[model samples]
Structure formats: structure tokens, C-alpha cells
Target chain A: MKPEAPMTAEQSLALITRMIDQAKGNVTRNAFYFLLWGWIVLIANLGMFVLIKLSYPYPFAIWLITIPAWAYTMYASFKRQKETSALTHLDSISGWLWITFGVCIITLIAFGYRINFQINPVILLFCSIPTFMSGVILRFTPLKFGGVMFWIFAIVSFIVGHEYQFLSGAAAIAFGYLVPGYLLKRKESQ
Target chain B: MFDELDPLLHSQLRLAVMSLLISAEAAEFTFLKEKTNATAGNLSVQLDKLQEAGYITVEKSFKGKKPLTTCRITTKGIQAFEKYVNTLKQYINK
Candidate 1:
């Protein structure tokens, strides 16, 4: 809103909030995706772990949850596309990097049966790229740490048994995604 | 000691423009105009004032033969803005 009089402190703060929301520099929305996938990965990891322990017939069925999650992610992305028009160069880079990650991860999974479904370590290895790049892009240390966590756990997954890989995945998502996601969200909100 | 709010940024239009640029790597002239609901002539003048103050840099270029003007906030502008906000906060608290 245009003000006829000089801006008050309240007006100034409100204008800052409004403009920041409209700006391409508002990468705070990235926190949403991080938290989303973090929770999903956590659940999927633990679910697979528990299913295997209980001797369930289809431990891999736990991954089916990603189908709904993927649908929701696409819907949210499209909605955001409609709400925002301005995109900074860095934002496009972050976006394209993640898209590339999505493609690579899917290809790995599709061909995973060939390797007897031992794709967890490789998937975690793939995780390092986007996570590290996003951290570098945002200049946030926590996210960079998150990326390194994935690298550590990917190696850890190789040394451990199949069921325990799920545990490491959960740990990785917790420290990696959920922690930085919450921190990033809090920083932006403040 | 109380500090005076920067007069250049105390105005609504200029402050609004600065607010937008402060959060953006860069923004288009049309984006500022549309967001502020200011007319082209008025927005142009406000942008010029900001540029003169060294609070912002405006790059005029072309996109497929159409003139494009983009604005970005400078380091000095960021310092001025932070000071302005801190002063405004003290006044508000008082």
C-alpha cells in the first residue's frame, strides 16, 4: 500500500515483510521441502527397518508413500509458480540442481533391482550433491554440515547390514534435513 | 543517544523501494512499480533519487529490443537501512 504520510516504524517493518515475501531472495520456502522430505525419509527409513525386523512380506512397500509425497510436491511447486513471478539467477540454479537430483535418483532406483536393491548407499551418495550445493548456495553452515552428514552415512551404510542402512538414513535425515530445515525457517521468520 | 532516521529512507515510496531491493539480488523496474502501485513517472523519479544517494544501482539494458531496467541495493544502503530500523525500533519502544 502507498502511504501519503511519512512511514512509521510499524509501516517500515510491515513493508519489509511484504517486500521480502515478494522478493526472489526469499528462499525461506526451501525449508518447506527440506522438512517435507526429511519427515518422509525418516518415516520411510524407520518403516523399512521395522518391517524387516517384523519379517513382513513387503518391506519395500514402505517406499510407496513417496508416490503421494511426490504428487504433493508437484502441486506445491506449481502453486508457488503461480504465486511468485520474480526469480533470481541463484534461485534458478538451486531449482535446476534439485531437478537434476530428482532425475538421477529416479534412474538409480529404476535400475536398482539389478544390484539386488542395494541402492541405499548410492542414493545417499547422490544426496550429497544437492544438499552440499544448496548449502553453498545459501551460505548456510548447517546445510553444508547436513550434506557432509550424508557423505559420512553413505560410507557407513556400506559397512553395515541392509536393515541398519535404514537406521543410518533416518539419522542422516534428522541431522541433515530436519535440523537445518527448522533452523533456516526460524532465521527467515525472524 | 537517539539517532535520527535517515530522511532519504523515511519516505514511503523510497523506503518501500529500498525494502524490495534489500531482499533481492536485483529487481526489475516494472516489478517495483507494480508492487508499489506507483506510476511509471513517479517510480522512475524515486529510483533516480535512490541511485543519486548511492543507495542502489540501476542497470539499464535490453531484452529482445525492449528496454529493461534493474535495481540492486548497495552495501552502504544495507548499513543505512539497518541503522534506520534500529532507530525506529528505539523510538517505537520509547
Candidate 2:
């Protein structure tokens, strides 16, 4: 890469193409976030289902776990920001997109009581947007499949009864986030 | 009938640097060095040259206790790169 080397037009095109492909950036690190949220929500969904089946009074209280998960996500993001040496434009946009998704989820939670807490379907529907968008951004097919699964499961939750809605939500998170998350983790590791 | 290539982007290492910077929002000095496999001294010198031409902006700051240098391509750099590519395309297509 010496500056003095005379590069021909063809060589210049080759170099530009090689360098641009190399600059695709490390988007695979997103696997960790996907896996984290996937597991957390998966557990919460199944936990609510179990509590409901047991006739527990505070079945909905299971969602309080997201508070700690949110704190941990923020702390990890700050630490990650410190170590990142480059920022891709697509990555920046994806980060902002997820932030918007978080705002939407919060809005849903605040207004859930008005709809009699029929939040599972709406939450899964919101999840599909960022998941599908990230797949498009990263050119990862599994994530797109996961996004499709989320949509299907959202519909499933709408069709199911109260206690079974959590079960449908659990299946949604399993296929949507957990499955893609694991695949992404494996791909990144490779 | 062909436009001349921009001399600043006609060389090997500088062109590689611009290529990397053009695609990224920002890249660190170490990242460029690692990707280019260029010596630190040489990369630093070439970066200064691009900075002088106003083709890129270099920021020097501290990342914790260590110094960090980040580079980003400028609007002028994009234009120059584009012009150079168009010119090169003319040469090769001829």
C-alpha cells in the first residue's frame, strides 16, 4: 500500500472494489443483542404462561424483568461504544431504528390498560419491524425469516385465548429472535 | 477525450485510504493501518497529505488513557474520488 506505487485505472478499480467489500463492517456483533432480548422475552412469555396456568394472582408481574434487562443493555452499549474503532452508516441507522422500536414498545406498555392489556400481539407486531429491517440492512436471510415468523405468531396470539397468548408469544420469540440470534452468532463466529 | 485522474487519489495507499473512508462513517488510524498493512509511519504521512488537501478530516483525541486518531472523508474527497473514477472509467472503456 505504498503511496509511490503507480496504479493503473484497472488496478484502481480493483482496489476500490476490494476495499469497499472489506469495509462492509462487523455487523455480526448484533447477534449478542438479538440473543439477549430473545432469551429475556422468551422466558418472560413462558413464565407468564406458567403462572397463568397455576392460577397465580400476579402473572403479569413477570414482565418486570425487562427493567433489569434494559439497564444491562444500556451498560453494555456504553462499554461497546468505547471499544468500537469504526462506525458504519448502516450500523448507525440500525441503532437509531432499534431506539425507535424501544420507544414504540414503551408507548404500548403505557397504553396497554386501555386495551385491556392485550399487549402480546401488538408487541410481537412491533418486534417484526426492526427484525425484518435489520435483515434487509445486513443482507441476512435468517433474520428475515425470523421477522416473518414474528408476524405469523402475532396473528397466532390474536387467535388464541388469554393464557395461551403467552405461549404463542413464546413461540414467536423462539423462532423470531432465538433462532436467528443463534444463527447470527454462529455466522459471526465463523 | 478522457478526464485526468486526480493525482491525490492516483497513488496506491492514498487511494486505498480514501476507498475505506468513503464507505465508512468514520474509521480509526489503527483500522486503516491494519486493513492496508501499511507501516505506521507511512500511513501517518499519507494521512497528513490527504488532510492537507482537505480530502479528509482527522481528529486527535484521547480514548481513555491512550491517544486515538479518527479519519472521515470530506465532501471534497467524495467529489475527487468520483471524478477520478469517472476519468479512470473513460481510460479503461476507451
Candidate 3:
């Protein structure tokens, strides 16, 4: 095939479309990180809810699981970066968006005591932005809907007491991360 | 009447390479070859031509035991590609 042949406008347009599709097709939708954080946050949220309902003295301590989760996520991200030979615009944008989300979460946790632990709703709200943006970038409707679900849960968490917020957070993680992550993994396999 | 398309971007292989690079921050030589289905020698020649025109920057390094070549489009390349597309549109519209 003469890939260097001169082209008319139609041929040029066709070639452009073909190349863009090829580049997009090469993208590996590895949802491992999403699944990892999904289960971790889901468990943490539900665990906290159960502890609080049981009248445990330090129910909030359950969130300490995030420390180990954060470490694992960093290690995984590094490995993924080393494995990747190309970085697409979507990948760069989504990576930075998640990094920004991570920084925001850390900041919120650092000041959680000052905020009287009324941080769940804000966290859910924050999560929606990156999730929605990621969905848009990847052109995945499930993830976009997942982001909307997070917004709805955030509103619910805001209206409920602190104890109920954990339950809402758990629901948010289930829909926002787990469901879409699974669907993405299935799509990649197919 | 249509403006002339940029010669550097008017060829099939070069245009294909530019299109791929346009959507990516950077791409490896193998990735470009795989996408374009171009032979390594031909791809190397076209890449060198694009580099000489200051349209792309190619970096060579060793990744573990293998040598890796990565290419990124320059600002000039992006502008030229955009102009080429616009000009192509004019030709198609006429």
C-alpha cells in the first residue's frame, strides 16, 4: 500500500479519520484503579456507617484504610506510567484531573476536624467533577451517568445527619466507580 | 478559489503521522508505524524530513535493552495542520 500517495480533499479527510480512529483504538481502558478505589471507599464508607450505628467510640478511625489504599494507588500509577509508551491528550487531561481530585481529597481530610466531619457531601461533590470529565473524555455514557449519581448522592448526604452521610457515600462509590469501572473493563475485554 | 495546502502536510504518510500526533502528546516510533502500516525505513525517512522542517521533534533513548524513538509535533506543525485542513475544506466545499 502506498501510504505516501498524494490525496484529494476526500482522501485527505478519509485518511485523517482513519488515523484518528487508530490512535483512539490503541487506548487501553484499564479500569483497575477505578475498581480499586471503588471497593476501598465503598468498604470504608459502609464500615464507618456500621461502626457509628453500633455506637463505637472512634467510628471515624475506619477511614484510616485510605492510607494504605493511597500508597497502593501511587505504586500502581507508577507502574502503569512505566508501561505506557504513548500519552494521548485524553490520557494527560484525565491523569491531571485525577491528580487534582486526589489533592483536593487530601486537603479536605487534613481539615476534616475543623469542618466537624461534614466533609462527605463536599467529597462527593468534588468526585463528580473529575468523574464527569473523565466520562466525557472517554466518551462513555455509563461513567457520565455515574457522575450524575454522585451528585444526587451528594445532595442526599447534605440533607442527612453525619452518620447517614457514610451510607450515602457508600452508595455513591458503588454507582460512580464500581459500576462504570466494571463496564469499562468488560468493554476493554471485548 | 482554495488556498494551497501545506506541502509538508499534503502527503499521505506525513499527513497520517501528523493526524496521529495531533491527538496525542507524544507517540513512539513503533506506535506510528503500527498505525500507519509503514515500513520502518520509510517511516524513519519521513520522520527525518518532518523533523528537518521543524514540524516535529524526535528523541532517541534506550528503554531497558531496546532503543526507543518518540516523536512529538511542534507548534509549527499544529498550525500547519490546522491550516491544511481548513484549505482542504475550501477545496471540498468548492
Candidate 3 lDDT over residue span A1-190, tens digit each = 3755768899999999999887776655757877998999999999999998899999889889889989988898888876787788878888888999999999999999998878999999999999888888888998998899999999999999888899999999999999999999888788
The C-alpha lDDT values of all candidates are 0.85, 0.90, 0.89
Better-scoring candidate (TM-score), 1 or 3: 3
Mind giving the per-residue lDDT tens digits that candidate 1 earns over A70-150? 889889887875444355656768888988999999899899999999999999989988998899888798999999999
Q: Estimate each model's TM-score.
A: 0.64, 0.95, 0.95
Q: Where does model 3 exceed 4 Å of error?
A: none
Model 1 chain B: lowest-lDDT 10 consecutive positions: B19-28
Docking class of 2: high
What is the fnat value (0 to 1) for candidate 3? Answer: 0.74
- What TM-score does candidate 2 reach? 0.95
Cα RMSD, each candidate? 8.9, 1.4, 1.4
Of 1 and 2, the candidate ahead on lDDT is: 2
lDDT of 2 by residue, B1-94 (tens): 6777888889889999999988889999998998889999999999999999999999999998999999999999999999888898898999
Give the Å shift of residue A150 in candidate 3.
0.8
DockQ winner between candidates 1 and 2: 2
lDDT ranking from best to worst?
2, 3, 1
Q: Show pairs that collide, candidate 3.
A: none
Give candidate 3's error at residue A54 in angstroms: 2.6
| Complex DockQ per candidate | 0.30, 0.85, 0.75
